[model samples]
Structure formats: C-alpha cells, structure tokens
Target: MSQDLQYWKQLKEKNDASAIKYFYDQYIKLLYKYGYHFCQDATLVEDCVQDLFLRLWEKRSSLGDTDNVKLYLMVSLKRSIYEKLKKNSKTTVTEEVPEDTFDVTFTMEEQIISSETDQITKDKLLECLETLSGRQKEVIYLRFYNGFTPEEVSEIMQISNQSVRNVQASALKKMRNNMDDPLLILVVGKLIESFFHEI
Candidate 1:
C-alpha cells in the first residue's frame, strides 16, 4: 500500500491521533469547499465537516479500510449534510428536497499575474461555467476539478456511470461552444487539458 493509504490503516487499527491530524490537514479545505457546493450556508457546511471528523474519530475502530480515503470522506460528508438538512426542513420526503442544490462559482485569483488578454479569457470562462446546468457543473467539478473517474463520480453523485459521462459530455460541449479557445478552460480544473481532448 502507498504511504497515503497507510495513514488510514493507522487510524483504523491503532486509533492514531497523528493519522487523524494528517487527514484533517489534507482534506479540511477540500471538504469545506465541497460542502459549500451542496449548501450555500457556510455555517451548516462548517458544522457538518466538524461533525464528520468527530464521528469518524469516534467510530474509527469500526470503520472499514479503504484505498480511497478522499472519496470515503466526500461520501460521508454528502450524506451528513443531507441528513442535517432533512432534519431541519419541513420536507419529509427525499424527493421533495430540491435537486437544484449544486452550485459552483469560478473566479480568477487576485495574485495570479495575467495580461489583458488573459483577463478577458478568464472572464469568458466564468461566463461559460455559469451557463452550465447544475448537474453539468457538478459533473465537471468532480471529473475535472477533483480528478475523479466517471465511475467514481457516479458513486459520489448517486447517478449512473452513463449519466456521469452524458452530463460531462454535454457540459464540455456547451463550454466548447462558448469558448474562443477550448484550451483556456484549463483554468477551471487540472484534468481539463487531457479530458478536453478525450471528448
């Protein structure tokens, strides 16, 4: 197993505090960012993230081992937020909860040095992203931003693998149509350059 995978094993087998801290340090920002995508309310996301780690720690002994710790955490956090929202809201049925909850906003970093042309390109990228549907955006974020496979994304979003591919294809096509240079979409995610070519 990789060293990264060992941390999870350590936590599960030994109840190691360092392993917990390692996971916290590695994933807190990502978890918070991902949590916010589901619920715009920062406090609820923050609380859910905190409670997630607490629950993980408390239940470490019974926790199963996994090669994909990040995915495990993401799945756990998603369910935690859903349960919390279900409890807080009057909507008793799962189907009654709004499906249009995924939201993503892309912005250029202030410190990145860029030319006038670069700025315009980034502006157009943001506009293109805004035009995508929520499911499309979520698929793009998972596939490109987080570098998850379509199979993994299906697990995360609770959709079929074919649905993941279809959503991503539609999203990429929309972005390609709106973009002046398709390569410029790399600003959004690490896998964009390669995935752009694949589609």
Candidate 2:
C-alpha cells in the first residue's frame, strides 16, 4: 500500500479521541473549503465540518479500512450537504442552475505562484471549471477538492456509481482539453497535494 494508505490504516486502527482530533485538525480546513464551495455560506460550511467530525468520531469503531480517509471525509461532507439541501426545498437548486456569484479569494497571480502553475494555465483551469455543467463541477470539486471516491459521490448525489464515473471522466477530459501545459498540470497537482497536506 502507499504511504498515505498505511497512515490512514494506522489511524483507523487506533480509533481514539486523540486520533479523531488529529484527523479533524488536519482536515477541517479542506472540508470547510469544500463545504463553502457548495453552500457559499461560512456558517453552513462550519456546521457541516463540525457535524462530519462528530459523526466520524461516533462511528469510528464501525469504520472499515478506507484506503483514503480524506475520501471518506469528502463523502461524509457531501452527504451532509445533500441532506441539508433536501431539508429545505427552496434551497434545492437544480444541477444546471447557476450558483450565486461568490468571491474566489485566490487571485490568479497568487495561485500561479503559490500553486506553481503559470498564470495562463491557472486562468484556463479556473475558466474551464466555470464552463463545466453544475453537476460536472460538483463531481470535480468532490473528487479533487475533497477527494471523494466515485461510489461515495454517487451515494451523495443520488446517482448510479457508473454516473459518477462518467461525470468524473467527462470533467477530467474537459480539463485536459483546456489545459495543454503538462508542467502547469503537474504544478496544479502538486498544489492540491500541498493544500491537503498543509491543512
């Protein structure tokens, strides 16, 4: 197994309050960022993160050997968000409905340097994300932004597992088509890794 998988397995085996605290401290920001992307409300995002950690701690003993704990967190967050949305019918925006405009705090220049991607590539990818259908964007966010598995995403989105795979594949294809710079793509990948690790 990869080093990350090994670490996660160890964490799972321990399943103590300290272990849960460690997980929360490490991943809370990433989870909040993901939740904010979906809900665009800081309070809601914070609540989701809190609820997810609470749920994880409560069910830690029953948790299986997940190759990726980050993925599990993402799945949990997505499910929580879906439930939140479902509970309020007026908040249920169709996949195609345009989300309200919100500030993207990461400036292009900052992202280029911090993410190690060229300004052009960074801009292109951001633009590409905007171009994607709402469902496609959600899948991309869940997959890369929060690291959920397709099965997890399928459950959250109430879609078939195959549909989740298809959306992810489509999103990747679109991103690849838009971003022709290999170096830039590698840098972006590294940035994503850094974001998760540093959080």
lDDT of each: 0.79, 0.64
lDDT of 2: 0.64
TM-score of decoy 1: 0.83
Top-scoring candidate (lDDT): 1
Q: For candidate 2, write residues 60-89 as lDDT tens digits.
A: 667677766776677688667766765655
Q: Pick the TM-score winner.
A: 1
Residue-level lDDT tens digits of model 1 in 70-175: 8889989998898888888987665445656889886544422234446666677678889998888888777657878887888888889888878877887787
TM-scores of all candidate predictions against the true structure: 0.83, 0.58
